[model samples]
Target: EKADGIFILGQNPGTNHPRMLTTLERAKENGAKIVALNPMPESGLMHVVNPNPQEYDNILTYPVKMLLNRGTALNDLWLPVRINGDMPALRGIMKEMLAEEERSPGSVFDREFIERQTVGFEAFVEHLRATDWEDILTGSGLTRDQIRAGAQIAMHCKRIICCWAMGLTQHKNAVATIQEVMNFLLLGGHIGRPGAGPCPVRGHSNVQGDRTMGICEHMSDAFMEKLGREFNFAPPKEHGTDTVETIKHMADGRIRFFLGLGGNFLAAAPDTEYTARALQSCRLTAHVSTKLNRSHLVTGEIALILPCLGRSEIDRQESGEQFVTVEDSMGIINPSRGHLEPASKHLRSEPAIVAGLAKATLANRTTVDWNDLIANYDRIRDHIERVVPGFENFNARVRGEIFYLPNAARDKRQFNNVEGKAKFVISEMDLHKLEPGQYLMMTVRSHDQFNTTIYGLNDRYRGIYNGRRVVFMNPEDVKDAGLEQGQFVDLTSCYREEERVARHFMVAPFNIPRGCTATYFPEANVLVPINSTADRSNTPTSKSVVIRVRPSTRTAEAVNELRRNIDEVRSESASSRSPTRQS
Candidate 1:
């Protein structure tokens, strides 16, 4: 709310985080210019009401004032950039900023901050200056004038908070695109301030928290040393396999055992059919989960569906009822207390499951007392406090009313580099180049879905209702492709000459870029190639997949497949059967 300007890109906070609309409402009321950069004009960014406050089950019980709340108008400007065009869009903005800086000198650029707090400023400026406006125009699908208007809006604001999600992360040039955003922020010194700096939003708070708790492929040396000191044993320095590498190994028969802690791994992973085959190749597959999903249906030779207590379920431990601490996207550590009793009494907590797995795997050779750790969860927090930095007095501090974890980038504008100063990274604008008849297809969640979980079939913003298998394309693109409104089309993506097809997606004429289209996932996940991933992160490039859309060549197999999955999930939900291990 303290920010003068807010730049939202990639993520849809309105649908994904509806409660955030309330915060945006506060910011707008207090005078904040919210700019939305997206391929599709998201209703969440444009106009939205805080539905969380109006969680009344019955319309009859709702008050007049609450019922009439039309909601707040959010975006000052909406930039409909093409899919994978965020890099060029950012570059265009930075180029315009540099021009403005050159024309007015210090009035537009923060010279003192740039000199004192940053390096590579000169090179970054040079890169932006030399960037072709033509390339920016073609790549971003926005004119030079439009780009300048955006820069003009940004130049006036003192504090800017650039927020993004998976839409920005799941790309080939994902890291570079974020660096461009940072470069823009660094130009005006937006770091280390309230309502300013980068905000990478996650669907789940514990996704980021998992990284803090050392559930990563590559743990930092500092974290390893801290663990060694606390546990009296040196943790492995060698990096473990990431999701992509693990799947690759499994497909190649290198990895035999697949044990998932939580989440629909098969559905969430890229190349749906490939991932299924990979799991089938495995000798054993186990998932500690709260509900049954498609993952259970497609398993290895021996599969175990070990039921675990969800975050909303009360975890009665050996000592007492337990709550898990999760770190939000903004680095706020909060204790999550469960309000509901466990659906099944036999279901174990995540900690208990982990401890059991550890005991079974390591036997008597384990260093830490697994039983004691599981008995009192606070003991685990004690271990966490000892190991993780900025977590000093973890149990005491987290139990308080407010606990904000210290962030180096946000707290002091401190960069963890050789020079200990933030470096301005300059990279080439790598836009998605689609061949003729090929549209850059990006997957998105409907208003009714979260990640891989489908809530409903309607996406009111796009005007599609009671339908999950549909593609949103620009009206011009639809006409150009010889596809009419409501036409059933198949999408084909040929990666390394190996073609993958997603059959029968209805055409949804939306306000998207001319050559770009949007489809829902795990429906479109079949088109996402396993090998094509982000440059540095190795994360699947789920956002950008080059595919050609044509009239459906086959039956409604793909669409029917989704319906079957939904029916299966709903059937599983209705059943009283507790998930169990099966050989």
Candidate 2:
């Protein structure tokens, strides 16, 4: 896919995908163009070898050489759209592209690609045609013109890659939002081909791998039957539990054993107070992680913290230097072997740990060779191959260079849907709102943090330093409440009758959007209500919450004294300003 230009939109590669820098650099060296559409600035991706925009702000940067350092691009624009507003902004431009396509038949819509490859496109196109631009602009919080410019670039580009992370996926309508994104890319025929597609930047290295390797509560029938035949063991047929359901079951005392493979469960789950209680109530709590985290401290009466070999650590077994298979972003499966020795002699691999526990607890485990299964990871791969699709020859394919899973990017002619058509679900925007004087509070990860780990106190990207327990608010909101920046505030959520109340978090204020404020996750997770989640996915909408802010006073007398002094001062000022006081 030779092209005159390259566009990277709605993704931050420097912090999230650092390895992509090589491809980006090579593309620049070859005189191919690059365009970035994002809100943040001054990252490795923005400053490629050839300086594109030496002195550029809010607009297009055409021909990189003259503007900055020795660069070769003609023009690139950094279109900054509002937060949680990508859906409407993208849809508006899609409308314009449709209009252009209609004007000139068989132009660049990739008619052959759509007709031969995709299904249910007519229904999708109908939905797009019916979408009102005014409603889109209002919901997206972007001007029609700005979105139109982005659309134009997408339509014109030959090879384009659109990527997004939690910023786009952790929303109430995230599924639909991402679906629309795919729709836009597919409309331009940019996906399923080399050098072009939709990429969801997963947070963890093996999150997708875990899902592919049968780590889900909801297992397909085909996969289950394959597992029964291949392993000769009857796996639990009924769906078990997801993160949310697991919490509910634990709280209700139905699930006594909480066995986590490798995750900061307490820190990752929603509603910190209830999650802590649920974890504490478990009869046997087990955490398999490389390092000790907050979950170890928030353990039950009988708890086991089993350390494990990190991805970078050597997985020594009878079979010599062992490697674990991890599926990275873009569906490429590679064997990840630890180069360093184990942190502790007591450490074990995740699969080994799971097998050991299962053997110890289950009586029917006599039929399975848990030790052999653990010693040779290929056995695990064989089981995976038999159980999961796209892994027909898991051992052979895995032994080679990283290979992609089937039906994810390629084989677009048929979809997983029974009708072989990608369904376009109809949805209406229902933005969360709070009462007057209440602002929408969202949780975000600091630049210095990874998942729940606090690497440092400074968030250089957001202009914060030496502090991780601070909140960002609009300057006007601070002034309206008689508060100043850097002032301490108590964040509180509303109570519903006899239901459990959320914890109040103490935070310092900084400058952000007027009606929108943000706090770091886990610490800020206490503010997120448990029932408040997305419609379809049931994913906790950790990004958005409605809360009230009160001035945090260390002493009750201090608050009382301030109130008393203010009342006295108001009385005196009124007496002086007016004819007389009401004494």
Candidate 3:
């Protein structure tokens, strides 16, 4: 219930969430207690209900005074943990809480509920009992006191909801980290109740729904069997491709064609240079989008940019009017109809575009009615129901404003682990490498940006304006480096990987940890190497990057001044460190 109260607002609804804006608003207005857990505050919903309560307690944290008052005391406890250390800190808290519950056998640990609803509590308990707080704190980069406090707050709360985004998932240990968060919630019996759950705020309007409606690379045996029975054809039983695998195949000259429903695949992917090269190698790269983006421009030898209808744009089909279905972060399926006219008349709906592509690609096939599926979306839902379990009434139940699905946590069902019970994953403090003058830089989104697009140059939450190329550092680090505010510096990484290279980056001083630094992603992504990814999950390790900052010999403005003053004298006379320096 505590984690559920965290709305994670100011995030771009179009890019990050397709249907979460309204639900977020309703949750806030209904006294659910809002905690805008983000670095930048630019979402329109972050209006002033109260002007002043207290000053910003932490330099890195957004001001919580607006949400905190005499009644909403929970808002005052809005703690800003480290950017990428979310899992370690959260898991550490869970471990501590479980230990406390064990000591007090008569404590409110909800063992009865765990036995009935969960499948793997014994192994999970054992893992928690074996976990050491020192490892958790060191891995998370938090003190023991901090973790205990966070755990105490969660335990005391009647309802708790843990909300997280790419910060938690885009790492090597993303799966394990997420599982730990689930374990934390389950330990306190927070699941299957109002105002609390594990909310994975998805990107795109229906990215989760797309996976629900057969967009997954991994097709389970049972799902495949059902699909085969429905279509009366032997559908490919082999696992297809995930986001990373798809790119790998494209890079290896194996995948001849690329088809994206509505994502800026190039911009959203890790290792920009490699992903771009892969796209260039493809025989046919295609995108069905509502707007033109960098991904469309980075095309193959033969590329196609098929414009599609936006969610807010009108959908005029053979049935006269049309609506699209989108699932919110809370698993609620809602209908979205575009009231405004299309940006272009030639644009087609995503479903229509998919149907057309299928018909064109499989012209010789006579199994499925491609055109009929495009006419009514109910047919698509019907096919989804036949294939994907837990979507039994995909056509009927989706008619409501907000309808939930049968998630194991939400439905109070058994845990989906190997042991038929939830497992408390213990993360050991494994230091890859760290040297003197090396700072851990985390990739973050700016208030002016949405995913990969630069909308403007301002971060209201961070209290910055007119720049997306600035890095945030601790005041102490800035002083120690002999660097002041608005100083230009070279941000270099310590790794030498396939796609990892240290380059110059501008620096701006702000409140962060002594050894920690923060930089905007995609722009600052060049500093992070492709090989420096999280464990098992293979997601880019954007959260943790060791960087060295050096005072730049030249400022961005002094380039022209230096160019003008350097006459013909230095052209012929070169010294020892003159024209070239190689490391």
Candidate 4:
């Protein structure tokens, strides 16, 4: 809300993050310029409403507040860049800004900040100058004028914030693309300033918290040293397996026991069939969950569904009703106090379950007492304070209304590097070329769903109602492919000569770029190749899948099966509507 300008890229804060719209709306009202750069035009950026009634608490006053907070326009500029074209677009903007600085020195670039707090400026300028505009223009699928417009916005604003999400990640050069974003911000010295920084909107709640508690494939050496000193045991020097690595290990029969804390492993993971096979290979697969989902259906030889308390359900531990602390996306720790009663007395908390498992597996191998740790939730915070930096007096300070964790780059404007300064990155733009019948397919979550949990079949953001098995494509692309609206089609992805098919996706023409299509995830996760992943992160490239869209080739038996289902539903509906129907 305090920023002079906001650049939102590769994320739809409206449907995915509706809470952010109020801030954007407030920023707009404050006369802040907002720029949206994404493959699809978002409704939230264009139009947003603050649902919170400021003064209207009752029926009479509610109308007054509603009438006052009608709506707000959130975007002053929008650039519709194609998928995987973010690198070129970002580079193009930087190139324009560099030229602007040359045209009128001292008015554009932050020379003092670049000279003192940053390094590699001269090399970065030379690289930018040596770059060809043809590649930037072609790869970005944008015109020079459009690119210059975005540059103009950056040039005018002193304090700017750049925000991005999964759209920038999940590619071959995900890390490089992010570096490009950092480089862009560094030019204007956006970091370590109020209302100015790189905001990476997390995909799920408490994921940042998970990383803070040392739940990562590769733990930092500093964290490992602290944990070792605290526990009186040397932590493993070798790095553990990530999601993709775990899947591969499971498939190789190296990992027999599989346990999932949360999330639908089969549905959310890339290559649905491969992931299912990997899960099936496991001897025992246990999941700590609140409710049943698709993962429960696709179980291993011996599956265990250990039902646990939901976030809202009260956790009555041995130490009385306990409240667990969770870290938000902003790195602020807050207590989660559940008010609702437990659904069942047998249900246990996630911490308790993990504690029990630890006690059983490592009986006397360690000196740590699992029971004592799980007794009171405050004890966990105490331990975290001792080990994790910036968490001193966690139990006392966490009770406050607002608390922000320490960030060196954002707080002190200090860069902890070999050179003791931030360096500008030079990233290459590698655009994915399409074949004759190929389209760049990316999976997206609908408004009605949170990850794999579907609340309804409708996606109100895209005007999709009562159905999820539909693809959002350009109308021109549909016509070019000789396919009409509402036509059923099958999406097939071929990697390393191995093909995977997702059947019967209805075409829904939308405002998307040519040669690019968007499909709802879990339904389209099958098309994401396991072999195709982001470079450094080793994360599955879900946002950059190459696929061929062809007419739905349903067998006669499959057509008969569909007819049977429809007939069964119609008959049930007719029977319920009969006059003799009992209440």
* Winner by TM-score: 1
* 2 versus 4: better lDDT goes to: 4
Q: For model 3, how does the per-residue alpha-carbon lDDT over 1-583 read when each residue is reduced to its tens digit?
A: 1343453421333235434444544455565654443332233334422223233345333344433521122232333445555656766777777777878863746777677666567777776667677666655666787667766766665566666777666656667767777777776677777667667766655465766667778767777788889988888757887767778789899998998877678877866777898899999999887666679888888999887777777788875777777776566778877787776678788888878877887887747898787777778778878777767777677775467777775676556767655554555434334577878777777654556655555666677665556678878888888888877677777676332543334567775656778777776777666566767666777777777888777675544433432332133123212222100
Better of 1 and 3 by lDDT: 1
| Model 4 lDDT per residue over 1-583, tens place | 6789899988889877888888887788887899898888878778776677762346565565467855677898888888888899989999999998999997788888888899888998898998799999878888999999999999999889988888888888899999999999999988888989988888555345887889998999999999999988999999989999899999999999899997778888999999999999999999988766679877779999988887778888778999888776778778887777777788888899999998899889988888898889888888899899879999899788758889989999888899888899887789777889888888887776666766666677789875677888999999999999988888898676989998877899999889888998878999988888899899898889888899887646445644564565355445434332111
| RMSD (Å) of each candidate, 1 decimal | 3.3, 11.5, 9.5, 4.7
Weakest 10 consecutive residues, lDDT, candidate 1?
574-583
Candidate 2, residues 486-548, lDDT tens digits: the string is 655677765343122232233445544456677777677877777777667778877666777
- TM-scores for the candidates: 0.94, 0.83, 0.81, 0.93
Q: Write candidate 1's Cα lDDT for 126-233 as tens digits.
A: 888899888999889987777887898889999999999988999989998998889989999988877788988875763658888888999889888888889878
User: Where does candidate 4 have its weakest 10-residue lDDT segment?
Assistant: 574-583
lDDT of 2: 0.67
The alpha-carbon deviation from the true structure for residue 293 of candidate 4, after best TM-score superposition, in angstroms, is: 0.9
Tell me the spans in candidate 3 whose CA falls farther than 4 Å from its real position.
1-74, 78-80, 95-99, 114-134, 417-420, 430-433, 496-504, 553-583
- Estimate candidate 3's alpha-carbon lDDT, on a 0 to 1 scale: 0.65
> What's model 2's lDDT at 255?
92
lDDT of 4 at 173: 88
